[model samples]
Target: MSRLDTQIETQRLLLRVQRAEDFEYFAELQQDEEACRFIGGTAPRAAAWRKFLQMPGAWAVQGFGMFAVIEKSSGQWVGNIGPWHPEGWPGTEVGWALRRAAWGKGYAFEAAVASIDWAFDTLGWTEVIHSIDLDNVGSQELAKRLGSRNRGRGQLPAPFEDVVIDIWAQSREEWRARKR
Candidate 1:
């Protein structure tokens, strides 16, 4: 899909492909300790800038990347969620990381379901995976709610390769069947 056409809406959220205007919010998310803890821990603004650029870059280079999630109720940039498979990655991952303020509200699950559907139906992905930090109980629970099983351990790309995580996944067939 063209960058402008990458928009997915749900009952309470709008998932749009990342754009330059989203940098500030994205940077804010990366700088929040609680929010960035499992992802890569907090970073300074300079580092956050590089990280912010990755989402849009992924869409440009990989054709699929995290969606800048906006809450319909508040029209706020809550965080990002969707497909992510950087070089040397373990799997095509459907991941999520919301600003700390957006946690515990079911936004991640809601956006994730839409993302997974798009991945299977639009992106034609055979399976979807989530690399979750072993200690991230919240995400593990969300993965369970989505019918994903903790398959095993997995590795990430360089700079993060050493940070192993649990690979939670389900086939596209399983996801479609579960969504029914």
Candidate 2:
């Protein structure tokens, strides 16, 4: 997925791919326990920036994408929400992770709802996927808030428990109907 450093303006947040300037803030969240707990572990600063540098041009290269989530008001980064696939999963998996401080204000729901709109309306993807760590009840609840249904078990990458992962999904038709 190629989610470059392009900026997508939402009502309250600026959803962009990622940039080097965001490294420090990005590193902080990656190192945050509550933030990275469900997302696995923190990376070394150099490694984090190396990975950060890789995001700006993926959508053009890859058929599909990932993006860095940013708050428009403060220009501060809260977390990442994007589409990442695990092997040959049917569709692009849309996922998100936000800092603990950014929680409870409905930022996740607000920005993600717009991202979902872009996925179907802009990229023209017929189906979008959602998955989260089983123990991350807050995210599971957020999926419910976004109206995705659980599709059940699957294996994720390292540090992720090989437990029952809850898969949540939405089709283009479903999303379009929801809009009307």
Q: Cα RMSDs of all predictions?
A: 1.2, 2.8
In candidate 2, which residue ranges exceed 4 Å CA deviation? 1-5, 86-90, 157-164
For all predicted structures, in order, the TM-scores are 0.95, 0.85
Give each model's whole-structure lDDT.
0.90, 0.73
Q: Which ranges of candidate 1 are over 4 A from the true structure?
A: none
Worst 10 residues of 2 by lDDT: 55-64
Model 1 RMSD to the real structure? 1.2
Task: Give the top-scoring candidate (TM-score).
Answer: 1
Supply candidate 1's per-residue lDDT for 55.
82
Q: Model 2: per-residue lDDT, tens digit, 54-128?
A: 555455566335667788788888877766554555457777878777889788888788788877777777887
As for model 2, its CA RMSD to the true structure in angstroms is 2.8
Pairs in clash, predicted candidate 2: 1-64, 1-65, 2-58, 2-59, 4-56
User: What does candidate 1's lDDT look like per residue over 1-180, in tens digits?
Assistant: 486469999999999977777778888888888888899899898988888888888988878899999999888899999999888878888999999899889999999999999989888999999999999999999999999999998877789878879999999999988878
TM-score between model 1 and native: 0.95
